[model samples]
Target: MDDKYYTFSYKLRGDYKASPQYFFVGTHCANEFLDITKHDPLPLFNPLVHEQENHSPGNSPSSSSGDNKRLHPFNQELLTAINMLCISWDIIPKSGLDKIITFTRRRSETPNYNGIEWFNQIVGKDRQRRSLRIMIDQLRENNELKDLRFDESNNYLNERDIVNNIN
Candidate 1:
């Protein structure tokens, strides 16, 4: 299949006459259950039934409580769905796993998603701030000109050429 891209936005609060929280982005055929790659997966599942099983990142083999075993029979169904998607697509998950963890307890304005502790370790404490300062300066001064040229011929192949390439 050719590459496809989607941008998902959760419903921002306002009375749009629709459910304020449920707005999601998806391909024409995709549904909420299949959006685990983009957001937290558990909320879409049966809320009353699911026992929280904390499998650390990379499925660390930590044992779940005894109740978890009883739930495993039903949990396998969830696994099957995920397995099928993994089998078909490369599953290049654009959203980081850390965001799912954070979404559970806190609101977005409280604490921003984590940065994996490496950017500060390697690039020093001020690198991010310095980069942002430079970006803001360029924006305000309007001195950083963007290259506004494109090679149209290379990108826009004639219909005949496109058909020929496909054939």
Candidate 2:
């Protein structure tokens, strides 16, 4: 029998007080795991779903006025935060804000997609997720986003106080 292992380490960009560094290690077989010859390549990220959702019932031509309505404040703030964090960390590039905004707008047009899941997909890989998680943890530890708390009523982060904090 043969055995193999993979190990990696990474650091967050800024001076976060909670945790400054991170490391990870895992075990797997090169033949079974690293070998992707049999698997299909990942599909291109598609915006078609967003397009379709925009044309759906409540948002159809007859109700075009709905397009003028603003996205929920909480969701808007969350996307802004994600964009800011990603750009600060250089995860997505200078256009990260545009990508985040486009993605968020698409998701907003679609009621069925899970926002958290969509976020995870955009981050795309484990390393990025780790970096983002650390940043969020630091933010929570420092109470930077104290105004954005989970609301029991809506089962999502409350954004009533987030308006003043966004900048």
Candidate 3:
């Protein structure tokens, strides 16, 4: 009956007969909570899964290509840089790349927009190459990353190319 706590209850509406469940809110204890939803929940993000996949057998950038020879050193370097940026940003590479492109395009719309100036403002001049902006630019400019196909302006990926690559 404390002022900070209250009872909450819910019940299923269907033919399944069950008593309502009660939850006491406003407990100061950190672990005292229940998930009262009817459906299962999935994680919004899992960095460990991506980290494991990156180090797994045959998942390396060199091995991903078809010719059996390692990827071009520049391509390899770019991929490594991009992977490091992804780790720092705590985002998956595919979605992260998309977000970078979207952010860049939005920034470009301003009158007298300057890519280098804006990027330096956000990431600082010293760390440009290691920053998300530079990593995304390198990825978009590289032809060796066959899974991606950029438009003429390099603003977005072709949906058909992405689907074909996936299959």
Highest TM-score: which candidate?
2
Q: What is the TM-score of each predicted model, taking all chains together?
A: 0.18, 0.31, 0.25
The C-alpha lDDT values of all candidates are 0.27, 0.38, 0.33
Question: TM-score of the candidate numbered 2?
Answer: 0.31
Per-residue lDDT over 30-74 for candidate 2, one digit per residue giving the tens place of the 0 to 100 score:
223324444221111111123333222222322322245455554
- What is candidate 3's CA lDDT for residue 43? 12
- Candidate that beats the other on TM-score, 2 or 3, i.e. the better one: 2
Error of 3 at 76 (Å): 1.0
Q: What does the lDDT read for residue 137 in candidate 1?
A: 38
Model 1: per-residue lDDT, tens digit, 25-118? 3333233434445532222221112333633221222222221223222222222222222222334222332232234123322321122122
* Model 3 misplaced regions, further than 4 Å: 1-56, 59-61, 94-167
Query: Which stretches of model 2 miss by more than 4 angstroms?
Result: 1-68, 91-100, 106-116, 124-133, 139-146, 149-167
Per residue, candidate 3 scores C-alpha lDDT tens digits across 1-167 of 42233234456778345644545554222113323333222111121222333232232333321234333332332333334445455444342343343344344333212322232233332243354434544655642332321122122113223211101
User: Which prediction has more favorable lDDT, 1 or 2?
Assistant: 2
lDDT of 1: 0.27
The CA-based lDDT of model 3 is what? 0.33
